[model samples]
Target: MKVTEAAAQLGVSPRRVRALIADGRIRAHRVGVGWEIDGLAPSKERRALSVRSWLMLGRAVRSRALVGLSGHDRMRTAERIRRLRESDRPSRLLADWRPADAPAELYLDSLTARADRADDDYIRAALQRGPEYLRSRFDLAEVVASERAIRGESREELAERASVSARLVKNIESSQPLTSPGEVRRVLRALDIEPTALPDMVLS
Candidate 1:
């Protein structure tokens, strides 16, 4: 089968097929000019990691330990990290896929260790905060921005749906308090979120 045919069968782009071949995850043979895929391999069910996990992986790639990775793997990892940083909502595949190499395994382990320490610090901080302080730190900006990105809606589109000005949506997302509670509720309702459920942290 040709690369295009194999890609179709695998439900991935031609570029992704090539990447899989390079990673030795796919079997292919060189033909006259292009390569011919033997057959489709059994697909692995990989879950996407959290945004925090992706950030940790990016950090690991930037560390001095990156020199331990193969030149090819290092270049690919750096390119992917650049794309991930530039994208507003990076693809889930970026978090799911990684090189199956010893160096990559070590990097993953390092990310896990960093995450464990961060989680512990977060728990400790939360324990020290009073109920009122915790309520006030609901992080409305983060929630609104994340939800908007997940829905793939621009500020203009969200504002239109919420029947508010785009500037108002931007202000809310930038952590600027909205004076009108009704407007805030409308925005939350447009996002299919329960306004009453969230604490009145950033909204007036």
Candidate 2:
């Protein structure tokens, strides 16, 4: 698809598509004097899509635009709330989504104003706490190590799989910090493991 079309499909502006192409994250080719995005970096695309969706939801809520929200808007808002409540939410995406053309302070100010009027204190507090609570719950290193060990993966092979140095993997097995639940979740996702599978280690 052409750059503009691809960006539109991704729900991002055309400039973002060009930037990704320029950064070599997305492959493109010139076709009839226009740039066409022929392929995408799946991981990057997923990340971008996720961030974009979160930002969109934040933007809508901050704008106080939900008072009259309907169908898609309501669904989008609910999704954002769910994701924000998720552990290791990459909460930074909220701040990162503010448009450059618009001051971030403005967006935040708007969010604060809207939040103040919200009827649900639980939702507001969750938003205020952000994703830090989730990060503190799980250790990425230990999760990765556990997954590798359980899979009968060789230490060297596991290190490569986890994209970490052998030394790091070795240390993680003994003293890894589960500082971020999100990291643990990603490791589990990679290995199709789950926290419930290790009931003995659940935080008290």
Candidate 3:
């Protein structure tokens, strides 16, 4: 497909497609004199939205407070919008983006309970505790917080990297009695950090 056609099919603009091609998000091939799409679309069917973008769109779609978006269409919409030029896209949707106010303990507790109830050994043990599962179970708050302290990554950076906020990070960090386990894993995963490097923390 021509860049223009590809853009239309993706519900984005020609320039947006071109930029994505340049960024290597959407693969393209050189034809006679123009670029042609190399595949049906990018390898990933849908791009995850930044937490900020999600909040903005949620605001426009309704009134009063709302929780996070669920399911696939939201994923597709986020992918389409992310590839578009920011200025050329729709009006700014989010007010001032922050993380959802879900209590970190609640999700972590649920995950722990499930792990305890499961009878399997390795799978149950890994489920009982692992970086990916912990992140999902805890709504990714702890990971966000540690990044803030270590790297000073903003809400925007965290959103881009893992789709959450500084407030969520701070909350998780301050979640007294310290539900630090989940975040410990989250921080390592988010920052591409290796566990062996943290001998002090690990030994302690």
Candidate 4:
């Protein structure tokens, strides 16, 4: 189908359709003065073109937020308003622009997690821990505490990453006592510490 026809059938603008084609997300080829798209392809082609404008608006918002351009960056935040006039989406997001402008660092951290297809808490925690935060200790529990301290991450956050209770993390860090094999593995894995390198036993 022609780009314009595909855009119309998908209930979006030709501009968005062209953008998708350019990004190689949509299967298409340019010929002569126009482009052709395989609207019926099974490559998620017909999955859902529903988010065209919404994604446009979202990209705009994220771009503006990245540039620290609060309430500005109309293409990302405002241009679509004229097309979809008086919609609640823009109004709602606009209301909380301040928070989105600065955006918590965890938000992007979570995004990186999602990008890696990492669904487990331990993996998320490890990514958040980062390589620079790795510790140099050989003791089991002390290594755990050192790992957490090096990252400057709270017990609560580490607990979430390990998918364990915060109380358990605290106890491990404080008492330095031995626990079940599984619990030790979970905590160490969350901290990105090699389980075999530091067993549950105390190191001399």
TM-score of each: 0.38, 0.26, 0.28, 0.30
* lDDT, candidate 1, 1-204, per-residue tens: 998887655545676677678888889988987889988767562344344444444443434123333345544444444333333223333334433332445545544444444343332222121211112213555556545653547899999999999997887777764577677778877865554344454433
lDDT of 1 at 80: 47
TM-score of 2: 0.26
Cα lDDT listed for each candidate = 0.54, 0.47, 0.42, 0.49
lDDT per residue (tens digit) for residues 159-193 in model 3 = 45654455544554444233445445554566554
lDDT of 1 at 128: 24
> Candidate 3: minimum summed lDDT over ten consecutive residues — where?
87-96
Between candidates 2 and 4, the lDDT winner: 4
Question: Per-residue lDDT tens digits of candidate 2, residues 6-109?
Answer: 76455445665676788887899988877978875552323433434545565544432233344565555544443333313223333334344443455555
**Could you say which candidate leads in TM-score?**
1
lDDT of 4 by residue, 57-172 (tens): 34432332112222334233343422222221222222222222333444433433343452334322322323232222224445565446445478999999888999878777
How many pairs of residues collide in each model?
Answer: 0, 3, 2, 1
The C-alpha stretches of model 2 lying farther than 4 A from their native spots are 1-66, 103-204
C-alpha lDDT of residue 152 in model 3: 35
The alpha-carbon root-mean-square deviation between model 3 and the true structure, to one decimal in Å, is 17.7
Relative to the unseen true structure, what is the C-alpha lDDT of residue 54 in candidate 2, on a scale of 0 to 100?
Answer: 47
Show pairs that collide, candidate 2.
135-180, 138-178, 139-178
